[model samples]
Target: MADIQDFKSTPKYETFSYLPPMTPEKIRRQIAYLVSQGWNPGIEHVEPARASAYYWYMWKLPMFGEQSVDVIIAELEACHRAHPGNHVRLIGYDNYSQSQGTSFVVFRGK
Candidate 1:
C-alpha cells in the first residue's frame, strides 16, 4: 500500500501502481494521496488504451518555495521505472505560479 502519510515526511523515490481498468476505489485512493499536497479532484476521465491520454481536474495545490518540480519529477519517474509494464508518459504541463501548485497532470498510461 502507498503510505499517504509520507507525503510531507521528506518525499523519496516510490512505486505506485494505478490499477488497470482503473477502479473507483483506486481512483479515490489516488485522489486522497494527492489531497495530501492540497489537491482536490474536480474531474477525472479515462479513455481506452489506444489513445494514450488521461485527463484529470484537480484544484490548485499551492506549492511554496523552490525545488518542487524536481521533487515531483523524481517521484513520478521513480514510480514509472519501478512499474515498467505501465506505460507512463508525461503529456503536458501548465503552471502559472510556483506558489500556486498544479493539481493536475496529464499523463498517458498503458
Candidate 2:
C-alpha cells in the first residue's frame, strides 16, 4: 500500500519566462506561436520580495482559441503597467491537460 499523500503533487508544467524582457514585437510573435499550438495565455504577478512565493495571484483568466496576439499584448502591457514595481509573468495553459504548459517573467522591477 502507498500513502495517500503520495498522490498529492504540484503542477507538472510551470514554464518560466525568458530573462531580459522581450520586445513587444517579439512577445507578440511568441504569443502567435503559442496560440498556434493550442495554448491559452494568462497573467500572474508576485511581489519582488516574494519572488519565490507559490501564491501568485491571477492577473488574467486563461484565454484560448483564435485569440488574437493583440489581445494578449494588451493584457501583458496592462499587467506591466499595473505592477511595474513587481514581477509579472505570462503563462500559457494547455487545455488538453488542464495544466500550465509554459510561463515567462515579463517584467521585473524594484
lDDT of each: 0.36, 0.70
Model 1 misplacement above 4 A: 1-67, 87-107
Q: Roughly what TM-score does model 2 have, to 2 decimal places?
A: 0.73
Q: What would you estimate as the lDDT of candidate 1?
A: 0.36
- Give lDDT tens digits, candidate 2, residues 21-55: 46877777778877887888888887777777568
Task: Show where candidate 2 strays beyond 4 Å.
Answer: 1-21
Per-residue CA lDDT of candidate 1, range 24-94, in tens? Answer: 35544454455455432222223324223444322233222223444544444554455434443221222
- TM-scores, all candidates, are 0.26, 0.73
Q: Distance from true position, residue 71, model 2, in Å? A: 0.9
Total clashing pairs in model 1: 1
Candidate 2 at residue 96, lDDT? 91
